[model samples]
Target: MIPIDLQILKYIFMEKPIYYFKMKPYFQTSEYHDLCMYITNRSDTQNSDRLDKRDYTVFDLETTGFLPEIGHEILSIGAVRMNGNSEKLDEMHQLIKPIRPVPNHILSLTNLSRDALNQAPSFLEGFQRFLTFSENSTLVAHPAHFDVRFLRAMVKRWKLPEYSPPCIDSQQMAKYALPDVSHRLDPLLHYFNIHSLERHHALNDANMTADLFSELLLIMKKEHNITTYSVLQQLLNRQKS
Candidate 1:
């Protein structure tokens, strides 16, 4: 008959018990298990840090006018995603047809005439495409309030649920990151050494915003150590309050 100690050891090793055996030996008698355990624990801690990365989408809208209450509508919407460290992913851009005619003043500003929008889909269709492309990612915009207001209005008109995704306003970020300077997009781009190409186009503006946001995120990460979504949300709430 097997010795009682050996039998207990065999049962602990071979029974495949329901609960984990923390005291079980993990290495051969000739090897050290403490080093292995330390390595495993360190790997787990590193993986936990990696899991806290952030995801964001930088976007821009070219509108037919300024105020939504005064019948302004979005003419085009463009966006690009960024992973934890501000690495950009694929981009999305769509031209939208407004419910009302494009005014001469808007045409002069945006250079998008009625004929250009004639071939495009309606605002609802364009917004649906944009939403699908975004895949529920957090949004970043230069002046978030205007773009968010327009998007919220479109969603409401289409009877869709409200979009409550996390948002980062580059304008606000600029104010916080560079307290002494003007917070306009062009100036911020210049400060970050991001070149501005097509000034008023939706896609170009979106790309520029992405670059600016990337630089701003690097700054935030280095200075504030903002590595998690909850921390970012708290900072934004504090800014709002």
Candidate 2:
């Protein structure tokens, strides 16, 4: 029979546990500690946290396919940090190795080959890096409902602590700002007079989405008087209802 100490050592070395996740006693290193705190401590009553005063992480994900529920996995993540509406701060782009084979259409759409992604980091590593880059910032995505759902699905699958940050859907915001205009990213790019980037590639999509979000913010401020985060969230909540 295996001794207790031997069993513990086997779990540590042979079983391959997530260092910070399950090994809390040996190493109490929670990588997501600050991110969780920031989101948790955010005051619902802070009405003065205006849109222009906040920092944002505008992000895009290129996945094998939609529907994370069916095992469609993320292939890449790209993001850019921005202060307020316009000032771009930093960027992060990382490829994630997926367990399943990449589909042909996805390859064409994202311009990512399996060979390229085989050399990339695993999903856990890539996600951790993304969280670090996005720490303490409100998250913005063109269609945040879809993007954020994928994020939540993956976080749950990985057994990581739940991360529910304040998220803004730029597409939804665009709908409110310009009721007559098409809300899709391509159309909005043309509408905003922003130069087009390579579509579907994660980083390029993120960069383009950042531009779209900035344009939407300016329009919202002028047309809707949505100058603060509270006002914007209220607008979004109202739209939902």
Candidate 3:
């Protein structure tokens, strides 16, 4: 027979498992229908001919889990509007209440509380406000795959309007521009000598990403002559291949 304390430990672990982070993807058959079409059908009018002349909305999200299909939800969004590589036009930050309670680890990581989130607006209201702030600017985010995927998941779940902005992944941009260095935000921040923001805060991260992307834009223009959205896409694709 097991010791009493060991038995209790086993029962606790078995009854209430803690997911420190999600590793497995939660696949959905509808993802292709719900998410892929948005990418496929992005409006050509939204793509700016010149990178240096374009307007962009650089954004970030704090979420409860990695995969949205498994009930993971967005906790907050942070974004900034920029004109080309030089001018920052505006900023936006919003907290969204999830259907489930915020986990202890997430609360610690984000400096957010269940009480605060409980008082916040639902994802629909907050995201709608963000869309208004974003307008029709090109969407920019570090690791666009994660943030955009989460946003698309929410859009699908909420039956919101199709998100049609041309999206750019700043992380991929960094990887293409500086193929030698680490592309994670912290190392890139250090590499570019950009000042660090409070990590895990959505707005701060967005601001940092915007700054990093601006630097990258200048580099791409001067070194690679990547002047247009089409050229930028081609460069990124070549890097992937």
Question: For this target, which candidate reaches the highest TM-score against the unseen true structure?
Answer: 2
RMSD of each: 23.2, 9.1, 8.1
Sort the predicted structures by lDDT, highest score first: 2, 3, 1
lDDT of 2 by residue, 120-145 (tens): 97776787688778877889998999
Whole-model lDDT values for every prediction = 0.68, 0.80, 0.80
Candidate 1 lDDT score relative to the true structure: 0.68
Tell me model 3's lDDT, rounded to 2 decimals: 0.80
Q: How many backbone clashes are present in model 2? A: 0
Q: Model 3: per-residue lDDT, tens digit, 1-241?
A: 4565664565356522432122112223354344345444544355458987778999999998786755568999999999886699999999998766677999999999898899998675687578667766788999998999889877765554566567888999999889899999999999999999899999999999999999999898999888898889887877768
lDDT of 1 by residue, 132-157 (tens): 66654677898898788777765544
Taking all chains together, the TM-score of candidate 3 against the true structure is 0.80
Each candidate structure's TM-score, on Cα atoms with residue i matched to residue i, is: 0.75, 0.81, 0.80
Error of 1 at 49 (Å): 10
Candidate 1 weakest lDDT stretch, 10 residues: 43-52
